[model samples]
Target: MFRYYFLVIYTVYMLLKHIKLLYELQTLDPRLSYAKQMEAVYDKPKSFMRGCIGLTGSTVSIHQFGKTPKGPVLYVHPKLKLADLAVLLGHLDKTPSFFAEPRAFRYPLVHQWLNKMGAIKKNGGEHTAVEQIEEIVRKGQSFILSEADGIDYESLSSRLGVPIVPIETSGIEDMQKGSFFKRLKPADLDLTIHRAYLPENKRLRA
Candidate 1:
């Protein structure tokens, strides 16, 4: 019985140790820089312009949506080609902003896409997504990208005066379908829980 109890305790301790390691790795992810940049632009006032919003789906679906009256007249479809996104980013002459969400930094793939982009100064405060959108527009931001799959395009379009375009990518829709808790596997939850214990950093890396 003692031996069995010792084994159980050892297992639990190892599991916790694994969780700590994962949290550390997540904090070190380079994409966190991108997330911070996005946050900065969303919250602050700066000279931004030509702000466009995009909703991604399958490439074929985007084409079909574009035909309708509600479809965006113009957009960029990266189609999971980071190079394409990079080119579009270059053309913008500024880093695009992102909708506020924890997954923006926590998810590597999404952050990888947004990393190293530009960011405006921060206004600082808890703001709703709609409010952030308005703030970004007021500051003259050119584009705002939603978290991969969490935003309600219809609700946002109805609330805002700007046009919300559908820009289809090959795999992004599926990739971010469950970016947060709903998507996490049982084994991954421990790391997420551990992340919450870390001190939050409000000021983004420059």
Candidate 2:
């Protein structure tokens, strides 16, 4: 009876593991349309992180800033107007997206379980930007803007090898009605995507 039960449990565990892997595979994919844009832009490549961009400090208010839950994970990127940032993400092909061993368990459940069982220590603690390129930030899709923004943010960009883009948009009367950033009417937003950063090099522009 015990042997049969053990075998049954083992089979179920393996089946679940396979199912989880498949689920992780499906959710972790680059956006197709955005992927094309990334290839074109990168062919004439502007920055190391082709799709990701950094926003200005003033624009960071649109997001709710808070610390990430402490576990085996690390919190990167501050946020604001994630919807707006979505408009700018670049897409990548499968080749560049997954060229290495994945960082965390492709499935969050496995990551959490292993961490709880003391099988894994510090989730994001052991990861590098390359492993995450396919997991968190798709190679092609532009990055979601994070919390704090400024010259300091260049460090994160440098680490990720992505570009920084600052946008000056119109139609801000509602957001900055009482402040100096207020505008009366909608107009064309001027956006400049800065050059990409190499992890080991210094940039000419500040």
- TM-score (all chains, Cα) for each model: 0.29, 0.28
**What lDDT does model 1 reach?**
0.33
Clashes of 1: 5
Candidate 2's TM-score reads: 0.28
Candidate 1 ranges beyond 4 A from true positions: 1-87, 91-95, 99-127, 170-206
Q: In terms of lDDT, which candidate is strongest?
A: 1
Q: Write the per-residue lDDT of candidate 1 for residues 87-115, one digit (tens) a residue.
A: 23333323454433344545543343333
Among the numbered candidates, top TM-score falls to 1
Q: What is the C-alpha RMSD of each candidate to the true structure, in Å?
A: 17.7, 17.3
Looking at model 1, report the run of 10 residues with the lowest lDDT sum.
189-198
In model 1, the Cα lDDT at residue 188 comes to: 10
Question: After TM-score superposition, what is the CA distance of residue 50 in candidate 1 from its true location, in Å?
Answer: 20
Q: Tell me the deviation in Å of residue 29 in model 1.
A: 34
In model 1, state the lDDT of residue 141.
45
